[model samples]
Target: MNYWLVKSEPFKYSWDDFVNQGVGTWDGVRNYQARNNLTAMKLDDLVLFYHSNEGMEVVGIAKVVKEAYPDPTIEDPRWVVVDLTAVEKLPKAVTLKSIKSDERLQDVSLIRQSRLSVQQLKKEEFDVIISKAYEN
Candidate 1:
């Protein structure tokens, strides 16, 4: 299964909100690269639920419940979205600052292309981050 990371501000849609909701459609992605990433998503794919702007950390895990579809929240046809189901909350959030400072994570898209709201994660990077989440 492919691994991905998607970002949202905590105020707008926190990890708690996602878990409480159980499953929800992920939308409002405007960038072309981000849109492409959404389109590539498939059912059962794992996603990192990231809180951008404020804390800038990955707070939980989610699984894609549905593949890409035309975003319902917008009138424009350019954007797409996917349904995501909350999997589990990270014991400790992996901050973007911490990720960027780690040598092992140097090649992660989160640091290489910080502007991309949605991006693919390398398998090694995925394993590393998830392991970090469970760390003390």
Candidate 2:
């Protein structure tokens, strides 16, 4: 399955809010690249939910429950969204600082394109982040 990371400001839509809602429609993407990433997602693809802005950390895991569909929140036909369900909260939230400090993650999309709301991850990169979260 493909791995991806999606960012949302905690104050706007935190991990708790996602778990409470059960399933969320990941929408409001306007960028061409980010929109394309959303369109590339497939059912059951794993996603890392990151709290951008304030926290700047990876907080939880989610999986695509539905593939790309016309974004209901906007009139623009170019935008689309996917349905995601919370898989689990990470054992520990992996901070951006931690990721940046790791030599293995230097080339990660999170670092290469910090401003992108949606990013893809290599399987090895995804595994490293997961390992970090579970570390003592």
Candidate 3:
């Protein structure tokens, strides 16, 4: 399954909010690249939920429950969204600082394209981040 990372501001939509809601419609993507990433998601693909802006950390895991569909929050035909259900919260959130410090994660999109709201991750990259989350 493909792995991905999606960002949300904690104040607007935190990990707790996602778990409480059960399933979340990952929408509001306007950027073409980010929109494409959303379109690429398939059913059961794993996703890392990151808290951008204030926290700047990967907080939880989610999986795609539904594939791309016209974003319900908007009337625009060009945009789409995927349904995601929270899988698990990380034992320890992986901070941007820690990721940047790790040699293995230097090439991750989170570092190269910090402003991108959604990103694709290689399996190795995804695994490294997951390992970091479980580290002491």
Candidate 2 has its poorest 10 consecutive residues by lDDT at: 73-82
Segments of candidate 3 deviating more than 4 angstroms: none
lDDT of each: 0.91, 0.97, 0.96
> lDDT by residue for model 3 over 19-86, one digit each (tens)?
99999999899999999999999999999999999899999999999999999999999999999999
Residue pair clashes in candidate 2: none
lDDT of model 3, residue 46: 97
- Model 3's alpha-carbon lDDT is 0.96
- Report model 3's TM-score to 2 decimal places: 0.98
Candidate 2 regions exceeding 4 Å error are none
- In candidate 3, residue 15 scores what lDDT? 96
* Residue-by-residue lDDT tens digits, candidate 1, 1-136: 8999999989999999988888888988889999999999989999998999989999998999999999999998898989999989999999998888788999988998988889999878888899888878
Clash tally for model 3 = 0
lDDT ranking, best first: 2, 3, 1
Poorest 10 consecutive residues by lDDT, candidate 3: 127-136
